[model samples]
Target: MAAKAALPPHSPGIATGAGWARLRPRGGGAMRGYRYEALDGARALAAQVVLVSHGLGMAFFPVHSPGAAAAEWFGRLAVMVFFSLSGFVIATSLSRLVASDGSRFGVPYAVHRIARIWPPLVLAILVTFAVGWLGQNGLPLLTKTGDAYRLDAVAFLRGITLTFAPGDATFVIDRALWSLRQEVYLYAIAALAALAFAGRGARRVLAGGAVVGLVILTADRFFYLQSLALFAAGAAAAHFGGRERLRALARAPWLGPATLCLLGAPLLFVVRPGFIDAMSDGAGFLAYQAALGIPVALCLLGLAIGDGPAARAAARWSWAAAFSYTLYVIHVPVMTLVFSLRAHLDLAPGLAGTVATLLLALLGAEAVSCAAALVVERPALFRRILFRLLAATGLARPAVQAAPSI
Candidate 1:
């Protein structure tokens, strides 16, 4: 993993009542203070929370589950956080690349992004296929046609390429694939922006324009474009909220808790019956999602700014952060398999059953995800292979430097 640059010292350190120290950065530095170390663990925790919420929603329908409403709302919020954080991280990294050599969309950057996303994604797809094949007779959770699991070669290929269309039912293997597509699209846009704007001033102008473009394009189209606004929000944060600004925000005693309360506010409405309907009809779902991005962006900013013991405590989950992508990609299939087993055994339905199912699914998914990360997601193993392939095909320069491990 790449070592993040340290924050510049500007404001004096302030001690919070809870023994946490707040350090703010000063302006006029070399612009090397933007780092992601504080946000890694928080991102991991958010991803895990998303997995848990998905498991709960899958195991117990919202209509039947007591906490399904909260879980559903949490799942959406977590994804938004993921997008915002991704934007921040990508923007920071791209700025570093540009600073290093003034090459924004180089072969190295492209290769690194591919290596980062494709391996775990491909492996997860294969695992999903295997689960679908083996559990065809029993896996009731997956969409099926006739007597076998529904597997379309075209849709699978589209998914592999991250080009699957929105509202496509072909993603039965893993509904989470949709977000991955959006992520890839955002990467492409970022790469273009980086390439088009070499100077710092030009990049700032591009970022501002991109934010406005995202909002305008996202109107009434909540599926993917709407999500881009969160990415733009993150980019804005990276552009304007330097280490000093972020650290100052982090110093606030109530910021973290306040962000949590803001995130939780939607639960009150989500818990109500027909809340989904209300959102779709009355609130204009896509518009509401765009609105929701505001608080989610704030949460991401809070997480990035936070430091001291609280940040360190979160960073302790670095292992989870390392395997978060694998977990996100494969959890659905693993959970589906667990649900199949539960059905095969005819577990009685109630609180106990639901708890057992949820626990089993979570444990199974974590175990599988960890194994996949160890075997295939490790950059040391897969990146070398990818580099060799790229080199042989002349897609990458022979002397291209290895990208910093994420």
Candidate 2:
């Protein structure tokens, strides 16, 4: 519990080179400090979006129900947002590693990533199992079944490796492990992208080509590419953006409204003609998603371009933002259990168990996630172990220089 409580907020700041070096080049002096607070706030917002979407689904529809056209469309869009957010955060974090190490090819680089992601995930699985046990044994929450066989320790060990073969969807604890696998792949690709591109134009060209290939392949195999594309955009921004230009763009009059329009159009058109065609299958789906990328990318770009009131507010709460990863890890199980209990409550129809379940799941996941962060995730000691495994798995490289002093 203490581990969870002491967890740091989510602040994805500029990655200075290793060991207290300056972020700018040796002669580039007196630049503005990187905003850690704003980055953390962005992470918090992304996590909240995911939580809210999950809450809506669990409360309003069966896990598989498509709902009305509008509902179905929104659900799919919510998932797109999730993928895009993952890309942004991953790219940002990887940039930090690259800046810190001066190379993306060593042990410490990979270790940092594993330490950042796995602790909360492991805790989530353990806690979720506990919840499942309680629900199944008639301790508190009602469950869907009594005979579901909890996977054995061996199965869990296998999942920890995340090497499940194709067509294998079995995850004993955290069903979300599949997404994590995709995330790992994207990180690797991004690292390679950093290593491969020696010039800005080449990086852009390569990334553009990759995005096109991804659209054509559409193999669920390359679902990670979708995230990779968004990540590439951020990476490109980092590589190309200058402080003066970012500041100038921040003042653009129409940026805010245009961003809103792009994001809002899909929601507004949920019931309109060709809406399903746009949101659903085939070329329409591709076009709709590409359009969505516009807003998602702009929102992130806005963060860099301006330090407006919204950005300032986000920075203010950055310290409290650390629990997003923990919350993400635990929320699914908490919500699953909550949804399973609906039948037992005898609630009237249209009362969508959503509100109550959301309130409880939010509160519960937060409390528990915080505890895990403090006790399990935050210890500086376990970081050693986490890094070693990730390095062993070829996930990252070592730092080439001391990290830049903040």
User: Judged by TM-score, which candidate is best?
Assistant: 1
For candidate 1, the per-residue lDDT at 393 reads 88
Q: Write the per-residue lDDT of candidate 2 for residues 1-406, one digit (tens) a residue.
A: 1011111223334445442133333322112233445656666665566666656655664433443445545444444544554555544454455555544333444545566666776766666666656655764443322335454465455555666433221343345455566666555565555544422456546654664564456445434445445545544443333444553454466766786676566666554555545453455555556456545654555564457876787667565566766776677677666655554565433554557666776777667766766765553545555555555766533332232211
Q: Give the 10-residue window scoring lowest on summed lDDT in candidate 1.
A: 15-24
Q: Which stretches of candidate 2 lie over 4 Å from their true place?
A: 1-32, 62-104, 131-150, 163-178, 198-222, 243-247, 269-281, 342-354, 379-381, 384-406
The TM-score of candidate 1 is: 0.79
Q: Encode model 1's per-residue lDDT on 188-292: one tens digit a residue.
A: 777766654553566547665774575466555435665677777776665556556554654566766776676676666765676655443454655666555
**Candidate that scores best on lDDT:** 1
* Clashing residue pairs for model 1: 25-244
lDDT for 255 in candidate 2 is 66
Backbone collisions counted per model: 1, 27
User: What is the TM-score of each predicted model, taking all chains together?
Assistant: 0.79, 0.70
Clash number for candidate 2 = 27
